[model samples]
Target: MTMSFSPQVLLSKVARERCIANIKELPKFALNDEGSKKTYASVLVPLCVVKEEVCLLYTLRSSNLKNHSGQVSFPGGKIDEGETEIDAVLRETHEEIGFNARDVEIWEKMPIIQGRNKEMIIHPIVGVLNNMNVDNLVRSVDEVEDIFTVPMKELCNIENHGHLKLQREKIILPVYTFGKYTIWGITGMITHLFLQCFLPESLYTNDFMRKKYTIGELMPSKI
Candidate 1:
């Protein structure tokens, strides 16, 4: 089915309200540890017009990076001292891809996603970009190997989704593979959460749900 959502639609009042309302209904995870100190970070789920269609931007991390090297991820990083989550997301996006903060319109703040190490808390901030062209992105070669976009229609396709079985607790993860890039782990989790804002409730069953905990419960808490 063809989805009619566009960068403009994502910024519409109706869409924003629906997204926020859905987020409230969804379950939010928190860290399981009682005393483990947590490192906070933030990422921008950037939506922009690509080829006259709405698409989400993703980055290929440089292979030389120490963490999650050479992996596909959103433009983001660790929150700086005394900085808010929104500030961190904007700063990281600029530092990674040279995307100006003035061109972005913040829309939604997704639930916090905890890293596998159980000590890092990531805040996913959703936003729409203005006057963005993939070809014009000034990628930071030191941190980003490349930048790409996936249309909303392709992202919503059921055919593009899959699952990976875990070794512990029989946990399963929802995976999305686009071309040669495999989006899994925390990135996959964030993608799945964002999809919830647009996809029908029924589409999130069986392979998409990951486990009995529902898609939202797949990630543990960070609070």
Candidate 2:
């Protein structure tokens, strides 16, 4: 597929800006009457590599896992003892996805996003892969069931995604669903917020404003 920006260039811009509004927006989730009162620190990366265009990589957690099992998510995990959030995020990416820390060029970081329970703080890191090929990639079988990628254009285009409310006080965020998976939750919210903050405001044209999504379209694999 044709691409509008060089993966390196776009990531460079995002890294330099390090937009954090979404992270700041986390308190909104906390204040809402959702579930818990605990707070934990975690880091995740929107890992992208340039193919014909930039592609965001994701993983399906093994169904037997404890938290968020079988869900589509970015490569990441909880922060380790004495580790900074960025260091933790980079470290987790390598551990979970087998992405060489050196191969990724960080574009920017979104703000810390809080969990529904207000017990977890999630730092979103955006970066570009230094190389492209399966050989350079890795996945932990215990944590990841499968790894796959989707085009960057599909993500940046607002028309292909939408939001659904889970309850009066809760809403299921929008995400780019490809084939059998739907990118949702904090990852989906981060993706949605990224387009609003980092991409040029002009891309917010009518076409970008009108798209809506459905569960069938978002999770083709579920059916």
Candidate 3:
């Protein structure tokens, strides 16, 4: 079974020892198609505290990009030769958001997921941004359109959660909404996974995410 903890449990203030230790203990998994031959990539599940509440930084992809364009996503990209996932995350995030590896405290890596094209696998790493200042971030005009952070508490709200049921496959893909941004697809799945670990049953249940729906389905994703 996966270990559950409060949202505050991931706060940077108490993350050094027991909290981080427990995080590493959680169940881990990854998705890979046997012998499919795929490229590798990584994205940072960047955590930071704003006004004493834990928040996650996100980016709006530039519409100019060819893949996953004009979408909401964590900063990440294809890994360079001889580079580790940690290095790729640090490098990509730095290139996209001007976040330095020195300021990031990597906690753990969550499950792997197939990327948008099904030709690349994404490794999502959890890390805390020590004293992050969003205003100071320099976004890459060629890749990122805008950047924003959503508090963990807001994500726990039931009103903000939903799913896209794929009729043919009989699978429900998680979805979330924050202001003008609609988070679905791989990004939505990543957020769903991250939130599940932080919320106890009594605090926040993914009722909408887990419930059986008789109607309203979305076709399989193309991007």
For every candidate, C-alpha RMSD to the true structure in Å: 6.0, 4.2, 5.1
Per-residue lDDT over 87-122 for candidate 1, one digit per residue giving the tens place of the 0 to 100 score:
999999998999899999888788887787889988
**How far out, in Å, is residue 171 in model 1?**
1.9
Best by lDDT: 1
Per-residue lDDT of candidate 3, residues 1-223 (tens digit): 1123333565535544543454555554445468688888999988887766677889989888887777889989989999999999999999999988899988788767876566778888888888788889999999999999987767777777777776775667777777777677788788877766544455556645643333323222223
- Candidate 1 positional error at 90, Å: 0.3
User: Which is the better candidate, 2 or 3, if ranked by TM-score?
Assistant: 3
What would the TM-score be for candidate 2 when compared with the true structure?
0.76
| Candidate 3: C-alpha lDDT | 0.75
TM-score of 3: 0.82
lDDT of 1: 0.77
lDDT of 2 at 187: 74
Give stretches of model 3 more than 4 Å off. 1-9, 12-32, 209-223
Q: Where does the lowest 10-residue lDDT sum fall in candidate 2? A: 200-209
lDDT of every model, 2 decimals: 0.77, 0.64, 0.75
Instruction: Put down candidate 2 lDDT per residue, 138-170, tens digits, no spaces.
Output: 889889888888775667665556564456555
